[model samples]
Target chain A: MQPAHSNTVIEASKLGLTFQTSDGPVRALSDVDLSIGKGEFVSFIGPSGCGKTTFLRVIADLERPTSGSISINGMSPQQAREARAYGYVFQAAALFPWRTIENNVALPLEIMGISRDERKARIKRTLDLVNLSGFEKKYPWQLSGGMQQRASIARALAFDADLLLMDEPFGALDEIVRDHLNEQLLKLWGQTNKTICFVTHSIPEAVYLSTRIVVMSPRPGRVTDVIESTLPRERPLDIRESPEFLAIAARVRDGLRAGHSYDD
Target chain B: MDRFRDKIIPVTTLLAGLVVLWYVFAVIMNAPVQRDMDRRAGEDPRFSEFIGKTLAQAKPTLPAPHQVATNFFENTFTRKITSNRSLVYHAWVTLSSTLLGFAFGTVLGILIAVGIVHFIALDRSLMPWIIASQTIPILAIAPMVVVVFAAIGVTGLLPKALISTYLSFFPVAVGMVKGLRSPEILYLDLMHTYNASASQTFWKLRVPASVPYLFASMKVAVAASLVGAIVAELPTGAVAGIGAKLLAGAYYSQTIDIWSALVAGSVVAVLLVTLVGVAGRIVERSMGGRPA
Candidate 1:
């Protein structure tokens, strides 16, 4: 196992992706280079159609980048997938409606051949971590949207995966729900010590959650700016009122405008 | 009260209207007109009584109600399961074949559905043929199937069950295919992220997801199998089954007997369908297990 202090958990170079659509060969991404350090919370903030999701898909091996080499923990993304290196949460909660909250959380552990007793213990712990202990018996439809999403995060955490990939997981929630989830997510990261790569469109959310924010441009999407956060490690809800928070928010805005005119 | 008024009241009113119309026609239509024909036929002066008895035996349409009821009692209670003349024996013969056939068909349907879901070529090629197969009337080709199987020296339950299987499988196949594909794209991506293999995804997601659909389709399949078994018996000129009894009564102009046998067959079909529905509920509940 690599040391926790190792700076890079994911490395991508000269990554590109193209789709053969009816219109023509559409270049979805072009010449992307990025790295995520161990135990770091990196957020990809970009305009619509900026290929942020696509990049995440590539890293997860759900899609293969048309060009460039990428590795997760020194293995190819596909290899990493077989080894179950990371857990991914999507924009939607994506809970299996047929399964209750507990079963949904237990799914990955079940597949990974964990014994039943251990699986039960892990599921309870993870559900509690996401504040969903009482909801173990509830089906996805019975819960509020935010609760379903928290269950999804708990599912990702249950397998003890070292890396977590979240694609706008709270995008559909109300602002209040999103804020609560954001705080919980930070605590989850702190406790689990997992490297995270989150993709989103919210400027404040990106700036608030990320240790580093990678701003991306659209139309052959590419990274334009990489900003390291200057906020204190001990952040609370009141941090949003701080001048430092406002300054970083302003920097993210400038980066968004200067990199890509997202309103196309 | 409003919910009941909105949905049930209209339906009950319509059904009541139909029953009233039937009574009016029975009492009012062709009373004297049929008297002239009854006299011309010149059976007896008690012609009205004869018509009444026949109507009571077969139904309002032909023989009547009482005659058919009498025949059913005679065949089912007066005789026995081993008796060739007994409707109970014939019904048992038919039920056994139908039950076996339904089981075979359900298993085959699930296998084919799973295969089609997993393989692209099977999905493209097999599905069209399955749809087309149902359009071909069972009545048209039942004799040919019987003859072909008989020629090959396959006898007894096999031919009857094959026909039942043929009729029953289509509903299960269609239901299962839809169920297997019912998961949203996002859920599939979740499986992909978990690095779940195709088989793992199927057992944990697709198979469990398909349960409600499977049970629903099973009800249809069971009913279809009963229909198939009865139809299969017709082509064979079966001597010891309900279909044979109906055919014999028809040839002898025993209209009351024929009508009674048809009602008996319908009753059996309803019973079988009801059993399947109950079983489906049980299976669904069991597979769902104790909550989470």
Candidate 2:
């Protein structure tokens, strides 16, 4: 259990990312600042081509920001990794096709030199957490798209990393499945008490799930607004249909549009 | 269901027709010849004895099919692996070279594939040359490979194994290169995001992704290795091998011996290929979760 006093788990200040294409340098993100507290569910919502994904990548140390710095658990992203600071769930499941569901979840543990008996126990626990307990021996291909994604989430949880960075983890699912996953995700977040930094383009999704929503715009992308949701702590499916949720979602949409107008 | 049934009917009909035709032709062909030999056997003792030699010589062409069956059963029953003249002895000799060549070839192929995958320049320079290498007739090069290896003081199994390796490695190299590069762009980006080291990405992702391709290529390599070993043997005129038996049979007009040796070579190749297929299934089952 984390102490209440120091809730800050991730901090990024004036983070910028620039890629050198054949034509010239293209800035993907510019001067973005955000901090994620322990047990916070933060969503990065933006239009396409905005740096929401890039920002998540920066936090994950997938991409190095051109300027500014980010820290995880009071250490730089690299140092935090040495402490096993986080687990990343990609847009696609990225499950190793040659591995069974159990083995896929056991990958990070194997890398960390965990013993077989303990690894097996953790695998079962994580799979159970994702409601995938019975699918342990099945291959990734044998599962449906939604199930594969859930299994991937289970894999991220298998190592017990405190910070979970997700890049559009549910973007590919249909609406009905997406809503179900979102409700499950909120429950998972509440139960695990792990800080989650999720990236998505859906405004309602951000408003429904996040404690705070960071809205971004494209073309040398930068954050425009960070809205702290006023929804009650005990969030459920009913809250998504509430006036408060819709209003916050509309605000996120306006913030996204405002960032786009400013770019022009 | 109809499609499957239709596909099988033609094959079954053709096979049944061929078997009937074979028995009828065998009787028609052998009767006249057998009758003339029998007539000569009655005419004179020396001629009859000479006729017996001709009948034995001609046995391979018409072999009553039953004669070949009897020979096979007799050889298998008593000679076994320990006997010098046994089919098992020749098979073992062939199998050793085939297996050695396969191991050597597979390792070399994987290394070359890694080099190709890692370096673009190597891919450009080596890929075309590798493909071109296959176009060079194995028959044309067999004697040269044998002679060169002999000149280098390499003999016995090494020369034959090297020949097999030369033939077997190309498929594995090409197949693995394709397999290693098969990861999707999104997956690559995901690994990049994780800050995965190159070796980490390789073992965790690339190597596992290449399993199907590696096994598929092994089937081709095993067959090629058997061909290489037999070809290598032909050039060396090795004292103890099936190839030497084939050559001696040809020289002496012992056509039955030559045909039987051909059957032996084919049987060895089949067994090696089947072994690889079985191994591929085991690996695929263990790794990919179930057999196809």
Candidate 3:
């Protein structure tokens, strides 16, 4: 029973990861430090080779950090994971093609051994939250890509974990669908008040949705900058045109350019 | 209706062409025997007489299609089903062995696949041996299997089934292994995030994913099992089943009997494969997989 007022949800100190491949040992992340507070939407933004997704994976306990430490809710990532502390949405929807949308959403609940009636209630509620209520009986391939991703989000939200780790969940979508989903996601986040750690390569997306943006560089990946947003929590899609949003976007762009220069 | 038309036209054309070719070959092959018979009777037969005689030979090298079809119909329908002389009785004996062996082989294959997928040591050690087992021709081993089993007083269906099991299990083992490992790494990571036990992952993820592969392999395995069952009957000198019928026909130069038995065996194979396909479709649909 930890205190409810504690704001820190995830804290990483000097964390690093290196993968040993047939060619050589490749460092994916190095000397990273960050902390995400309760109910904060933190986005990790960088170029393709950057370890932003790796960092998210570390927090999810999908990949082990070779150095330093990361704690989720004051517990080791592994312990936190075992305790069902968070839900993850992959870059691809990654829904099981054999499962209908409703069954896919209900997967984690089934794994957690929830009773049938309760599982049904949570599935209905979460699908409604993602605006996917009637599409329950449809298989994943039958739905559009954006719909599939929303179902994936519904899957993540089904069990109602306190934290959500999303890795470029909408990256494959078209711009219109991406914008629509981003708006929906923000609304969902506001309503749920869950801490979200998102990884993406898009600057506008980072500036629009995040409370703070952590910019990272590739090749022995390390964080280059962390920018705090000054925008109000209740943001409209038009806020992308505001001078404040432009300023933060410019900073993220400059940090990205500076990260490229490190190779020289 | 268009789909049905698309399938029926080509198959019907090919079958008609095959029947025409069979009549031509039967005439050519039975000609020499007809010529010898005419000479012995001191009668110079006319071309029309020669053609008629060749088409209706008592035992041609390749029996005419109509002759074989007549034998097939008569043997299948005119005799009591329980009579040893009936093709239905022999086909039933062979089918029973095929089905039993297919069941045993499928279960064994799935178990082996599970072991190989779950244990790296088994994958390394058992996989090569499984592949090697298939290289020794079933024809060579069938007789030995029959002899050994007969020594142990295990005759008839069990020995034939053992050979069928041997031939059928390989495809299923290989396919199931491929299927069990088919889910991409990302899905496995998803399972890990859920803190799912290994058993949970296997049932909910691995088994369902492997189903399509299983059905494809079962089609191959069932056909092979039938071949194994027929071959196994060869060395036993058994008085029942398609293999025994073929042997008896060959002993008496009943080419019509041999050809009819071959056709009956083919019909059984098609029916068995179709049954497996229907089962696969139902299971896949019940599991919520999309139709082909």
Best prediction by lDDT: 3
Fraction of the reference Cα-Cα interface contacts (below 8 Å) that each candidate reproduces: 0.53, 0.39, 0.94
lDDT of 2 by residue, B1-292 (tens): 8966898888898978876675555665665666676687674336455434434535544543444545555654578677866766766777789889999999999999999999989988998999999999888898898889789898899888888899999999988998888888776765554556788778888898888889899889988998888777887887656777677767776656565677777888888788888887888788875544
Comparing chain B with the reference, what is the TM-score for each candidate?
Answer: 0.83, 0.82, 0.97
Positional deviation of A204 in candidate 1, in angstroms? Answer: 1.8
Interface quality of candidate 1 as DockQ: 0.48
Quote the lDDT for B196 in model 2.
63
Expressed as tens digits, the lDDT of each residue in A32-125 for candidate 1 is 9887889889999988888999999999999988888888988889999889999899988888776788988988998889999999999999
Off by over 4 Å in 3: A1-5, A262-264
DockQ of each: 0.48, 0.29, 0.82
Which ranges in model 1 have alpha carbons more than 4 Å from their true place? A1-5, A262-264, B1-14, B23-33, B41-89, B286-292
Ranking by lDDT: 3, 1, 2
Error of 3 at B79 (Å): 1.9
Q: Ten consecutive residues with minimal summed lDDT in candidate 3 chain B?
A: B283-292
1 or 3: which has the higher TM-score? 3
TM-score of chain A, cand. 3 = 0.96
Model 1 docking category: acceptable
What TM-score did chain B of candidate 3 earn? 0.97
